[model samples]
Target: MDNLRLNLGCGGTHHPDWVNIDFAPRQPGVLGYDLGREIPFPDDTFATVYHSHLLEHLPKRAALPFLRECFRVLRPGGVLRLAVPDLEGIARAYLTAVDAVARGEADADARHAWMVVEMVDQLARHVSGGEMLAYWRQKPLPAQDFVLARLGAEARLAIASAGSAPLPPDPAAASALEIGTFRRSGECHLWMYDRFSLLRLLQEAGFVAAEPVAASFSAIPDFGRFGLDVEPDGNTRKPDSLFMEARKPDAPAVSGPRVVQVCMQHTGGAGSAAARLQQGLSAIGVPSFLYVSSSAGHIPGVAVIPAASGQTLLREDDGRTLTHSQWPAFVQANRATLARHTHRPPGLELFSESETAARLSDIPAMELAQIINLHWIGGTADICRDTAFLKGRPIVWTLHDMHPFTGGCHYAGSCRAFEQHCGNCPQLGSTDANDLSRAQWVRKMTAYRELDITLVCPSRWLAGEARKSRLFRKKPVHVIPNGVPTDVFRPLQRAPIRNHLGIGPDDFVMLFGADALTNRRKGFAELRAALERLRADNAVSGILLLTFGSNTGPDPASLPCRSLNLGRLSTPEELALAYNAADCLLAPSLEDNLPNVVLEAMACGLPVAGFATGGVPDMVEDGRPGRLAPTGDIEALARCIAALRDLSPQDRALSRLHCRETVLTRFSLPAQARAYADLYRQLLEARR
Candidate 1:
């Protein structure tokens, strides 16, 4: 008998050699069925299964189970070929256009117009009618009209020709035709895919080997005969589609443990640390994967798995920014639970009662990982609720803050309720014995009962805090300061950097930065007070305070010192330059767990001055590389700043060398990675 082949979600495209299936079959001989539901075929039935622009239509929760069903039905060595629109490609195109406009290589108006079209046109266009196109022509955005006005007559003609056949002259008739087409077509994209995410999903579905393939290429025998790979005109149906092919193996088995590093986002302090660790592990001949909720750039030598996608932009109201794979209804329910707290803080908090997203436990990478190294997964991960998934796994949670041990609060300001049992939490402003904080603590207790978690603190202060926590009192905690790329942040000629920023060599520059400078925990108010004191005392005459970060606090003109606000720098290179240009780095954080800013600043040979709070003293040695004042002592902080300024040229030079050497010896990337690697091996061996 001829090999049985399947073409799932085939839409209007029918293949004679394959059983073409679609939820809405418009053509003859095509089988109609919901692809979200289980496949009806018996086990090991088909020699091949294929789908194009189909997987993204299913909700994230159903995607993997559907794939598993496909795996169950495929015969040994059967090929599964998939084609989906690439989110990364679209983002790249949008960013490229923006960059071109910034570089003056393209007209700003026209480029911006093209960028919006490139980002949204394909995803938001009317599926079966020309209504969207007509609406665009009638009321175009400024950028859109600019692009259209610049298009040549032939290009306009081609666009007109490509549009649907002329609508009926009667408005009612045209509306009917459009509605009819819409009813017959499957229109909305529920998710988006990039190469890394798609490949990871394929592996999760039990495919032994999966790799990207060209649109015209297929491993399946006589694939072209079915006319399924391309359109009737011999061009690809979706030009920018990402095609991947995977094959089933003869037997299924659990692979040996590898390293999977999980983080909330692939940026910021936590993200950078996780990425560096993965790179370090890879350098030492260990396989590593970095899984993030969202990412804009691909890390070299690390397989980056972004759970979210560009399609998220279309579903902004869904509240899935942190947990993209979650169901909309579940997100709503979770948000409702958070809303019950009348005094909840402004930022994100996950209080979901249940898990309704694609579980990481289902991913093959997680299954193969001997040790799941977690870093700053707060918004994207639910440790209390996801316990079932992590029950048997060995977990190494690197605490970037107090959130892991506390009741949803990233830092427990002065609340010691966590030392025993979290209740009447101050952060939540709840006095009830069974308030959200207490409930969360209870859930954590239950979840962690069977979990083998080794808590890693980047500072001694955080480790001590973890020991004081009721949840982690019995668990082992280790101090492992986060590492930085010393070479990248090494000392550069100060004068050149100052020249680049248009700063005078005579000016004494002080730098301050945070993800959000206005955040109360960052203590910008204290910095303000210290600056005022410095100005009053005339501590240093040519003083200039420079700030860089999102939402930098207050107006610069209001500050006592001459100030410059470099708002929200995008790259590490810019940050490094800023550090090099500065004479001293100011870190007035009220509470923190080994701030990466301090490390980067020190690595750049810049001394830091701040209150001797959590992790500050650990990095800033007293009377050496930098000075630290009493916590919350604005006057002392001002004095420390003055002391740093008063140092002679020779003493300052020695301090700079000391700062760089300290980072090189203690916080280098390889040292951090080696420590984690040893811990991983120990855990794996203990399990054996």
Candidate 2:
């Protein structure tokens, strides 16, 4: 076997033993030529190439070339170990937690984790004065870190002090369940992936032997500690994480052009949309370069470029700064950029070379893929313009909120100002909001003019807003609503499911789906106030408030309302059952593009009640499938719930039928997948 063990794109975290290659000299591994050019290794030089969370950031055009190069460089029978976040698994994890919470069987740790996350976010916001960008970028202040450390340490101590669960006599069966249970806690996950898409990308990239392997790690200390069976000498660590291993059988290594995927925003809400999208694409068919900022952690299919030593500044084409050692990589990257440019518009041809290279140095340019750009947060419009990553691609931007258009506010708060170049900002209480809005509008217009991108609005309301915006007025805009698979979110008819969960059949369950609690936008506080009012009312007797997504909230169990944090779901089926069990899904979001939970709940045949703002009007027709309250009307919300409780059986049945049909007809997972696939194919054809 060849002795070469390659750590592809290893950064500060690279193992001391491996031969590492990275663009940043500051990275713990070896500094090498830019990854954009052909790799320096000889044909069949290495026996193994290990890449973890490194591929999703590359431009789509360079993906094929990078894979071809990987194959050429690998010896026959050589193994390439690749790790990316598993999309399907994450989706399933999302569903399972929601299901568990609905059934009222939430574990303690799961609940605590949610609380910790909320607390941390709250502290972060308090310190940063509520600026989304500043809040996200702000590292924990000293006091905040001290508090976080104390909290984390306390939690760790408690967990360590808690005795493990006693294993069942049949260890095998119980082990499976325990493992399954641990796997279902996906609150920590924000993205999803799977083997089908991953394998396709590997195969397309020239790998002949590509297969997925089961891998996991135990968060629990030991099976023996939990009174479970242990092999005499077997490793005790639980293994649940997943990865792909691919190999090339033939081809001589060639130093070809290189490509890099740069991830701009890594932490917090700033680029969460981009992160989630990249996570989705990791498993999808494409092999590209990933270059992420130092602050960001591991993402499957991405390569974290280390910062080079101050000594090695290499001035490249378009005046972009890079390390001397990264020159070859830059050349390769430039070539890959050119290959992608072949599919772009004519006027864009003028500055393709400089435009492509300029991005790697800055944050905005890193995660640019050929067909899509996961533009993050509100302020990225400038980065979008300067980097020109949108030049040839169909940029599918998922606005976490409307901040980009509402003069730098995440929620427009009933402001029509955004419709016509946003002036007289309602949120800012200033007329100059229009001036700021027009500047952004001009920036967006400039971007729209250059790229063959599509403005993807998760909600119909957002899509309508886009139409009103001067920037997207002439662009191709589509409202592809988010979906949760009905299979995972179906009604649970099993008696034990209810009985084991300890939820009373007669209990009036008032439910809410959660995200960031500090984000007044999602309306958790309003939900809290409304629930309190219902408690004060005699009509609210036997009411149970259920919230998921955000773990931190008023104690559901203490209020005699069961709380469960299923964390993030790994499958859709798990979510369906939760939806089915709910009496009502609360979506009192002050402002939303579109809430997926509403659609998921309706699909599961449950009635929804929430504020009738954003794209929500597009989903609920007021008591047809679900009820919509006036935006921020706590009393109206309480009244609506009381009314829903009093509805006749026949009316409830009709409502359920309507809800199911609406989702099936318009928002089924299959329908969305097919639509996306069709769009992909169309883009391909247009490129040709």
Candidate 3:
């Protein structure tokens, strides 16, 4: 089969050098085939398999089995090339058109119509002949002219020739015959794909190397002989198609070392970030394991190892399970230390001076891993005590909040005491130079002084803060923003989502939430003041405020708008739907790293309006996605919200598209995984 090449679902395109197969024998030499069933070819029968815009025509359930069949039929080291319409590129182009229309750079009517056609016409256009043709025939002259403008010279000439020649008798009967042929043509797209989902699917189907390539670019020898990739004028058949290739491995490949991610609890914002990273790493062929103290529920693909069993340790060292019988004493010591801080703030953090629980290094998964990633190890683990045991291993500490660098406070708020040295702690209401906060700071500094550790901050703002901290000032800090699964949190129909949320079609919906709404750092009071200002100024009416998170704040009736309290949506799916149900997300955080709410909302195609604090400006691009007011400026915040409300429909649509594109381009899960993979490789190389 050295000279053999297979072109499945070739449609009307044919090549003499390749076995062109399609469900319908569209050409004289084409072989009749159906991709829904297994191919008739023997194992390892072809040197290369090429298919363009074919896989999406099959049902979603048939995608994997069909790909596995392709892998089965290909010879060792053989290539599989595919080209599918790029959903991301299409969405981005639609956004561009919407922006142009909003700016008056393009005619709104024509551009909007073109965008709608580009988005769904391929899927909705009937394969049975005259449905699309009939619709086009009924369009006005200007609309028909616009369609002709998008066609190539050859296609235009063909259309002109056909128009001049066709004056057939019984045109209705002729159309009926053509429609019958078209009904059997198998030309509808059943499923869609973007680069990330397609890459994961290819890897799952057993392709050793799957990567996207430029259109008309291939590694196959004499690939152009098939004439499958390009049009007669040498341009690509579809300009916006995602061209990709995968190779069957010649031999079994060596796998990389497993990643063991340690976090406090497998829930909350930090827990979600860690879990998503683990999922992403696993999808990209890295073995990932997660060890947590407690879990909200079962997490898929992560092996959750509980660090403690009540007061007993669960770790095994030297084949002996270490039991923390003195854990009760340690808890009492922790309470005594916390009791010293008499003036606790609304949201207070207190850490034990020392940890007497199971050492993380003694865990089986930790011992087996090549890398130890620490994330938000507050109540579950101790950095001062546990990190000392990880002297020789590569440790990657991901800062979820300020706790890692600060003196036990989750956020410093207006306190810059952690920058120079933790002393006269305000959060703990201590005037002593060596308070509990200072002691914790000193312990952490001494414990991690010689450990091999690299710090990863999810936002530039957080990284900057870490660089200022005394404990992590000299540590290697890398800024890697948290990622969201765009596939899961993608844009959904707003009308249905809003209807499901019991919101009126004309109401302006705004989302405000966090882990705890009453937490001072979350700025719920500021949001309430801004809403009141908006109402007093009569800047917005018919407003629906959707507040989520723990119901710890003031009553919803206190707000000036009709309000709904969702009460802490715990899952990403539920959160995604909530994001889609709203027009914009309001994040009035006084202090934050990279808030996941912004990323989640943007991924769901919801604009964000908030203060220009922390990493808010990094995610929300002022006028593009939404407006950002100066920090703590309630009136300015109110005006920003009103501005978003007053935006034209086209501009709002543009903002929604831009928000989704921001996540798709920068904060995708695959991008985060790839960044970590690079960092891991670097760390491993340095260790050697």
**Top TM-score prediction, candidate number:** 1
Clashes of each: 0, 78, 1
Using lDDT as the yardstick, the better of models 2 and 3 is 3
**What tens digits encode model 3's per-residue C-alpha lDDT throughout 410-488?**
7887899889888788887788998878877887888888688899999889999999988888999998989998988
RMSD of 3: 23.4
TM-score (all chains, Cα) for each model = 0.65, 0.51, 0.60
Worst 10 residues of 3 by lDDT: 314-323
Q: Which lDDT tens digits does candidate 1 get at residues 210-256?
A: 99988778899867767676655666666657889999888543233
Candidate 2, RMSD to the unseen true structure: 22.2
lDDT of each: 0.73, 0.53, 0.74
Ranking the candidates on TM-score from highest down gives 1, 3, 2
Runs with alpha carbons beyond 4 Å of true place in candidate 3: 1-253, 306-340, 347-356
Residue 232 local lDDT, model 3: 62
Best by lDDT: 3
lDDT of 1: 0.73
User: Per-residue lDDT of 1-688 in model 2, one digit per residue for the tens?
Assistant: 2255666665443544455766444653364445544453434556667665445434446556666667755667677776654556544554654566677773633533343333333222222112222222333322333223323332333233333423213323445555443332221222324788778878887787788864332221221232111223443121223467777765544222122223344433333333433443333423333343322223444433333333233434432233332334444654564454243222111111112222333321233234443433221123454535445554455554565444444566656666666555444334454444445455555555776656667678887777776656776777766544555555567345445557678766666765555666777777777767777775667666665565565565444234555454433565665565567788888877666678768877888888898988888888688777899899988777777777787987788788888877877655654454455556666777
